[model samples]
Target: MTLDIGTQHRDASVSGPSSDLSPSPPSSPGLVSTHAAAVSPAPARKPTTASNAASTSAILSWSDEKVKSCSSLRARKDLRRNLEVDVLQNIQKALRTSPNPFFNDPGAAAQEALRQAQIYKAWIQDQEGSSLEVAIVNDHPQGPADGCPPYDFVWVNGYVHDDTIPPSDPSELQGCDCEDDACNPATCKCFQKAVRFDTLNIYKESKQFAYNADGTLQDMMVPTYPIFECNSKCGCSSACTNRVVQKGRRVEIEFFKHQHYGWGVRARHRIKRHTFIGIYSGELVSDAEADRRAIVYEDVGSTYHFTIDPHPIKLETMRKRLASSPEGRTMTEEQLMQRVNDWTRLMDLYQAHREHKVTAKQLKEFNDRQIVEAKRKGEWSRRWQAELEAELAEWEARYREEPDNYLSLEPEDQARAEDLSLFYEDQQEANELTVDGALHGNFTRFFNHSCDPNLATWPVWIEEGSIWRPFFCFFALRNIEAGDELNFSYTSAEEVDDMVKRLNQIQVEQGTKPGTKRMKCLCGASNCRGFVFG
Candidate 1:
């Protein structure tokens, strides 16, 4: 699925650090901080663009009274901390002190649990608002019945909500068209509301938010979150968008936009290696169902494995099987096994016939066979014989190098292989079809095909419960600047920059001069790796 949050409207003047926003001294680039803009001097002029009208509104409203209010806000650091602590404490009480009794019991424990949940929910709202006045609306069972219902409880920045619900069209967050004193809703319809829910949402969704059996909160959780978005949505008011979902104690996937076709995602925020973005959800099929769908394959080792098609399989038969029954009752395990046996036997028979035919021709060759007809036959036989010998040699080498790679196992082992392969195949199929399952749902997908990339992808696995949960993270292997199309090496595992040298080795073997290895990169980083590594 693709999430195209076109035209994210950050104040160009208010981004980054306070120092960065100010004009820099002759010796260095300017540094600015969005957070520290509180004390900065007012600009001589105002931003007049429609997109910037919101900032201008805030600026125009700024007065000595407001400045005093800002000072009061700056002084209230402990309030934020207290809100966070209250959330933590409530979560701890829910896990430890609360009893898991039936709702029939209206005891103190159950009441207490409800109370704690309300408190925690309240904390979520405070986090969303940063101040207490604004409220984040979570789905309350009776709201828009079709969309993601629960809004962040907190009202911090980065919070998103559909202002127009069931009775209205999805609102396209728009800009303020103020130029020439005009209010053009066509050009400036900022509809979807977003508040800063990133830090709080990440906090709540992270494993750190989970309570221990004794009802204590984990103290080691990091509160910062990476959230970014584009500046505009181009013309399409309805394009796909994505979010990082936190499930249970561990952050797995919150599904991206499940509706829409050809959806893809790019990072609004810079994500680091090993971050758990999300998961693939689909119909889980049994081995028999997989075989009936024609997704089964037998390898050289005679190991049966299932594979979902590398591409979407549009076959009507497969579609019927998936649609007809939840458990796929149409094909039985016995029938699937019978089909597998028949297919394997037929394949073996064909192999034997070909081998015998080639062997017979090879044995007919003789030194005295020099007649025109004989020579022609001999040449043909020799070619087949040579091919057969090469195959035999390859098999022999494989057998000697890794004899155990092939398995000769009992019926149960075969069944296990069939089951394992089917599960894998099913997952692959879901990945291709599911909106958020595609790897392209993140910025890492656009990373150009470079033998050596300036970016690198790393797999993150949080080991727990005898399972290693896997997620992918991307990092800048080399410094990147704004506006540079990010690039990463095509080869997996190696960082992009390292892949460059590896590519040179291949080029060297092919006897080509990999000339002028470095060029100024378009990425506006101060420390860009000068060379492009495709």
Candidate 2:
């Protein structure tokens, strides 16, 4: 059962003292900068009203009275071992007594308090010295469903899985060898791959990074590429300019109720363009399990499964694939040299293209260079070209008239698409994953939908070793004011419009209308569409 932690928070809504029923241990040591709300006795007061509940950082403060710092060997571990169990028992009792529906049972609210105490404390401790706080609040008028949580889940900051362990330590083994305290874009080993290729086998003349000096994404538009940050594999210190998403969220966030929208998120302070908020996280399940849950969630009137599509990551995987190419297969000096020559010509072609077309001089130079290189290699290059032509012909036959389609595809996508979805059983090649955020997630789970959004999600490769498992980090698409709700489009209205047209045409031909799931959109934006997930 999901518990709304905010509902329990309403009990401690009075502005001054914390007055928590049970005071948890003080903030963990070594994390001196990040303080847990200290608590003290408080006079009986009113529950949180809409005015004070605007931002619950003030309402939920444990105390202004500071406890002694825990710098010594005598750090307190005063919390009861059976706290979660005891809370669960109490919740069971609350459920049995309550006449309201099970979803809004008082027990649900109580369990949420314990879950928050456990989860938030652990999440804060996971990242040393992190001052980030995702405060939970509710402004919904008290009623049978007043204790309703935004969504039911055992909130977690990291992915929850039984068998899928986290990526191996990147910093210890394969990390960058640079000794400089901060990484330099000119030579940092991590940026080398990103700077060299615009896509797999495509080259660029210069390095361009989207991350600004202050750790903000400079661009908020549709991304042409995913940001590869200085990860656990980087030798640079914490201040590296390229280190943004891995540093974790930097600002204050709140999960609060909206009058119309069930639950929504907002920042307490002004957010500049492209600020890194946090990643979309949850239970990491297989594609098949995700499908099972999809049916279950829909029947239950909610959906939390965010599919992890590997299409966007196909290009990013080239760095590793290219490194170890020809390891198994044999190649002569002439063959390797020919391969290099072909790559050089490809780089030229890519660099020469502007608005998807190349200039005549550059095209002539590219063709001349390729012809010269092929002649230089003689029979070895001739054999290589014949083999490539054979391979291309075989691939083209599968697509029929769509012979050049692979040109627009990432190498990995093309490879899988060759075999078709039915044959994609190789675990590494076919990453069919879905994050069940309904049951496990951070504050990011509550972000509502909008037709015109202020936030946009960009794939970011942090320490997650698999490019397929890159984090979906949300960046501020525009400068956002304090107290404004944060949102992103679930799916574009344009896509919806196109789908509707296609579906209508199909139904007209069949003389039957098949039912489709449609969740009406209440975003109320200037460009608001009537519905979402239509």
Candidate 3:
């Protein structure tokens, strides 16, 4: 399924952190995904232009003649950095705790949040030249009234990866060898990756590169398949048309303080439909850390938490796991007939039973008479079983001594391995990750909630040979006017982002309304779904 915020009016445009807003540092080249059919293969790339068209309005209030200022000071670099980077690290080490902290008491947590906020405000001011984007405009009468902690987070425009998920080895990645130094949509291996999901060749629904020739997204792509962009590994140049999200922020965006809805992002210019906005970036934590933080964020309005579990269990995932299973090997009679020559063909079955190999249903296939006859020659059967045990023991020893040689079973064992593959499957939960943007994140985290939003989220893979771990990307659902608050639905009916649809469906089946204490939404759309139950 395709993956799929709010507020009041009347603000004279004000500047707060506008000067500090700067373009993010580019990702190291040669990182990126490939075809789904292949368990392993290669990488994906792109650049951009989002013109901030003049704001549309009849009022002069949008213009700023006076020096725009914020009463709330910028965070102190030393104190705030110590709190988030050093002190927090020391505390975590001392307590031997995880990245997330659980106060258990809301009152104490709120107090600690304020203390940290003070330090952060000064740090931001001190590090005005620090590479962070997204302007923060504080127009509230009382400095900063909203936010569990008023600030969004330390700006992280891209994912921060560590040793939680599987490593992506550069040597294993494959890139498209485009002709004439350019990618042809018809043959570009990167674009062809979409064939497993949807393809232009099928013609039922156009699943071509989402962008038009002009770089704006084609409208039909709103609910389209996951995007696979051309990357540095590809022979194609940076100008490749398939590249969009990799181009980074194409439109101007900022954090605007809304009295009722807290901090929210608004467009700085006219954003054409399908324009790449920003990424939902943060520290990539394992599933366990995400779960711990989810509980701690009970009192917060929005949990800046996004789980990367979009890829369902693929057949290859199951096949590989089964091939690596202990019971996936077998022996054949042709090789063992020397000992079972006088014995019946059932000797193969008897040996397999002794080794406890493969499935039981295969053993049950034998007729009662065949088994009785095989057992009637108990002396011969014992000799055959001993030879089978000795051979298996030798093979096991060799496999242990030389794992590389035993990676694949012998040709005679292929049939049994196929049967074992059918009986095995595994969940990709271990491959899952969650991005927590509550404390340190790009402007995207400040997007307000909306029922009918202008933006939609989808998984994008740019790190080749790493399709399983996709980047959380946001795209414009429609043309957005400059200065409008950027919004995206917190929950989607499709199993894209949150589980609100499934949760609501369960409530209907059980005849219950949403939990009474659910976070109320301020989008104020006519079709507003009432609460943020995701």
Candidate 4:
């Protein structure tokens, strides 16, 4: 049976032979169909009459609808499969081209290096002499030591020495039996021995964690802690949480020269609180050696000797008495208020001295009266007072010998052992556990002093083969933005105030510029003390 599926509007006037059983016109326009005979079984006899054509046309139309429906469904299935394949291919391409999110991006690091180079007008070297990348830019064309030392980052199990010679048979502290990845303070023997104390050695306590939960300075004003990490003798793995400072620096840092200061170090990226920065690596000298170095470095107008003492000592009897006293454990509201008032008054006096509202002599007299009051009220022990007096006497003798040098010294350096006998009275006060980086040291030596600083130094002791030695490590005190210069208060707040006052008084008396006697502070902090010494 024939089927007419073609359009009927083509060349209507053209003459053509008409068959008796011409295929019936398609029911709708533009509907093309296969022959009904091709799709179904052929008829038993061929009918050549027009009456049979209508029946054949109806059968053909039904067959044509079925064929079209099948083709449409097949096309849809093919389209869906194509789309899925395209989507999967795109995913694979992205996986190949994208960077690993877990690792630092190389392009980012390169950009940072380029930026530093442009700012410092020097080449920015990568992790050439250190495990962590440190960019050094030395633009100082005049100094005897214009460039950094050619030493790769060295991880010393103990104190850093001047020469490369290692210590012979160093003693290591005994480690604990901790099975977990990190040691539990409750069970870890090393942690059990860690010591903590307030800044003034007033209130002391042991801490399980080195830092607070959020990594900020602990609220207790306990400035220093004896850091004891899981060592080789411990059962814990290297992934232990206590294994922070030992892991070395994990952030970008740059050592660039400053106009006023010879060289200064700055953070190349935002540093988080409590993150390990770098060790103040230098010659591990004896107390006598450090003193000698300090005297020699004084000529150059700077000293890199940083004491390693975790904290000042407290008498056993005093500590026991304080611990047993109920008042020591907690303060009453009245007592707290008095302490705050006392501190506020002291700071106000310091600010007045800075503004030249008070003379250095007058300030000293007031401070001396305060000390007397503290002693009278039993805030300071008789023994401590006597020790301080004796130290003052000794410093006075030294100042008498080099009065001229004392005048020429920087205010902070002068505070080291100069005319401010009342302020720097303790011989040990100037001679605590200092990590001297004057001769041979790392980039941390370049970190300048700030009254309000962004970095804080911690004393880290690593157990060697037979001994525990100190490592001075610095950490970000707060969230430091990238390209920010790093600094730490070289002296305590009280000492800084005294230094500023002393410098101000000296400048007024000598009729000289603010920075004539010492290096002028260009720190630009709102509370900048006008001198870098403080």
Candidate 5:
């Protein structure tokens, strides 16, 4: 599904509901289908001789005015940066308490929201006085009755409710008898019900879990497990081994608008694997309600209805059955770690070269050798090579112009330069578990879709009497640096054939040009499939 929020309006339009948005089909297994809307082309108008001459004159005048305007804007933006930094620092300082004080009290939450709004108002100058208020609230903006409903933010526990059906009674809590700090799979009743993990609490049937532990799942296509954490009913401490997701967010995150993909979420600090990011909270509606809203959203090209279909137990059983086959086994954990280390070293070297700490000859030789190796492995792309070369050239020019100033950099400045690029570059759609935030959701709703997502979603179940719903929790799939946008795949397949087919059908029905019906993907991944919807 494509979420195209037009720059002209605060309201977002959806292309269609995601396949997962509806009831899961029996045949597709992990694959969920999503809808895409028809895009109509604007009619072209004939320009008269007088209009053409006048247009040319206007273009020239606008060009001159734009340059001066941009320069002045840049200066003003720089002046505001110090104040912005101070505000952010103060906010961070205030939020240094454990368990996030904002979640504990309404006053604290409002204060935080107000501070965030100030920062957002300054950053998004063009959006001042707009209805889309930038605040750290726990609830999404309420929509109309026929539209999506508002929902409160769920911290650790999951909430399940369908508007079409009568709400089910909350599930009763059944506590385990284990008295250990952390529950042992050998004796814990809750752990005994688990089919995927062994007595040691380690995944029993696959090497994928091991690879994830070593931070090597970045490039590999692996299926994620439906993680069931120790809930409040468990006789374990908060620091229990199986209590990762329930611990709440450990890293700071921000929601901001992107130049291409409307609004997006970003990390404010470096994040590690298995760390709790946030919960995908929103109104829980039935498949019928989701479909109805989806059709309404499609009229305006809005697509943000995510389905909650956990990875079926049968799928994991199938993977285990295939594990004995040659094709089923992935790289060894040691080999994966080695590859990650090699990439990190290469990036460090590149940074050194850019800083002029390494000679030009050294940089060129390393680049040439890597290019050859990458080509031999069929891992190189012309687009990436050109981008790298251009960046290097730009850096060289900047260094020559300001040698001393550029070399004397702050710690954050150095870190920013080294961590600008994303960690992964591949796409997978089948394993994605999602929640729809099209009409109403918190900051997490702004996270854009990426082929090479650095974040992964995990299911968290907290015992709340008779309520047993899975909170779709996100975590850093690998180490992610500050300033990097958080992303995840919206589709389950790497191919764009389905997306293209939908676009073509829409174009034919709308009587528009074939190629002009689809939205271009702004995700700069090398393996991007052209359009974001696929």
Candidate 6:
């Protein structure tokens, strides 16, 4: 995916990265850096197929990059194991009609796959470091050429302090339940530092999977959002005043949003505008950990880096058809069947097919097969293709039905939901933002990015599920039309001068102030902010 680097939409919410030589002030309690909150995870969900030995090796090498740097080592192992199981499952399913099942032997396939995985890991460690992270694995045969594998790897730098040292070898580090004090390495003062690599490298070894040219992992592109940490007690309402707590951390800083801008809670249902979403709940995993626990969703026949929502579309097509039918209640079975057939046929016609031609040899083989055999093969292929196409169409339709509401169901949605919900609940309870963990305000998701915006961010405290939390609350600068794309200033309204400075810097970057990209602003508002916020 192409990043809109030149536009304000990309940098609006989060502050730009601080210079390496100077660190920003320590974030106030109840607030954290936006840069720490939003992360574009590695892409391990997508896979590809290979036909020859070289292609298979390329696919394995490609997938290795994506699986290596997952948060936890355990997760990465599990993911690789799961991938092997998926291959075994497909092999077994394929063997159902074979005279012998040697090729379908799970144990044999697993052994071979595992050996390959170990070798791949060794190769990566030799080129990169001892620890690596995998972000994406491309396994399709029709992907890009130029020796790119189907996966990308993110390498993590491990730091060890002089005063205290972790295990001489990470492999010897005993696993402890995070819930226990033993898991708190902080107690031991053991200096173990791990840092993620910034550069993305694809193996490009095979066309089947998404991989870089050098057997490294490519970044799973993520939509960036400006995140704000509440620095002091705040609320969407102006009447609310800042106050330091009598005890505990003083609540400060609020992220920005839109719903609370004008009507506040009156503008929405179920959740109030700027209300808390949910807290992060998944296991903390790096590339290695994620790969280790990577359990392939058994039903899907592949490894899914993120949680899979098994909820089927359960399409309402039948109901829609029934509603449109005339004299529907009194229709005969044949009539109903005819309607169903017509709809099915129409759907089939609309489905996209690979224009690539089939081989004459394959076609001839099909003709030579027994009638029953040929029919079974044809039915299997047709049904398989149809189901895949149908699911894709349903997903697309869902996105169209309500882009904001439905897009949240994508893989990244679960993580964002937890972050937003946690921010709100924490505020209501403790009257502060979460300071110890990452916080995310996915406003760009629903609000849409704008060079100009009509809302400002405010921090609020809320309680949820018996915990106090902080949230970045959005307030309106003006009464907005119902359908106008909701936008909030990425910079704080309280700090207008700084905002102008930031905007000026962006203009300079884009050559608008001095350089020369010279793209016209698309924000139609009369008072569109001239530049995107970082």
Among the numbered candidates, top lDDT falls to: 2
Cα lDDT tens digits for candidate 6, 199-315: 121111211111122211123311111111112122222211111111111111122222111111112212222222221111222222222322221111222121111101001
**Consecutive 10-residue window with the lowest summed lDDT within model 1:** 295-304
lDDT of 2 by residue, 402-459 (tens): 2243356567654444443223224332464556565446667677777788877776
lDDT of 6 at 528: 53
> Among all windows of ten consecutive residues in candidate 6, which has the lowest summed lDDT?
189-198
TM-score of every candidate relative to the true structure: 0.22, 0.60, 0.54, 0.48, 0.44, 0.21
TM-score of 2: 0.60
**For residues 321-341, could you state the per-residue lDDT of candidate 5 as single tens digits?**
345446446755334333444
Q: How much lDDT does each candidate structure score?
A: 0.25, 0.46, 0.44, 0.41, 0.39, 0.25
Better of 3 and 5 by lDDT: 3
How displaced is residue 455 in candidate 3, in Å?
A: 0.5
Number of backbone clashes in candidate 2: 2
Model 2: weakest 10-residue lDDT segment is 1-10
Candidate 3 C-alpha lDDT tens digits along 93-120: 3222222234334343333333333344
The alpha-carbon root-mean-square deviation between model 3 and the true structure, to one decimal in Å, is 21.4
After superposing candidate 6 on the true structure, give the runs of residues whose Cα lies further than 4 Å from its correct spot: 1-446, 451-454, 463-469, 475-480, 493-521
RMSD, every candidate, angstroms = 27.8, 16.6, 21.4, 35.0, 23.1, 30.8
True-structure Cα RMSD, model 6: 30.8
Can you write out model 1's per-residue Cα lDDT over 1-534, one digit (the tens) per residue? Answer: 111000011211101111111111112112111111111111132211111001112242111132212222212334443244334434443334344444223343333333333443344333332222211111111111111211111122211111111111224223322333322223322211111122234323442322222222223322112221212332322121211221211211111111211111223334333333322211122223323221111110010111222111212123234335555456554343334443333333433333333332343353222221121111111222233233332233323332231144455655544443444335433332111111011222223323344444332212100001122234345433333333433223233334355445546765765332222233333544443221
- Where does model 4 exceed 4 Å of error? 1-131, 137-158, 162-172, 195-207, 211-222, 312-434, 464-468, 499-517
Best by TM-score: 2
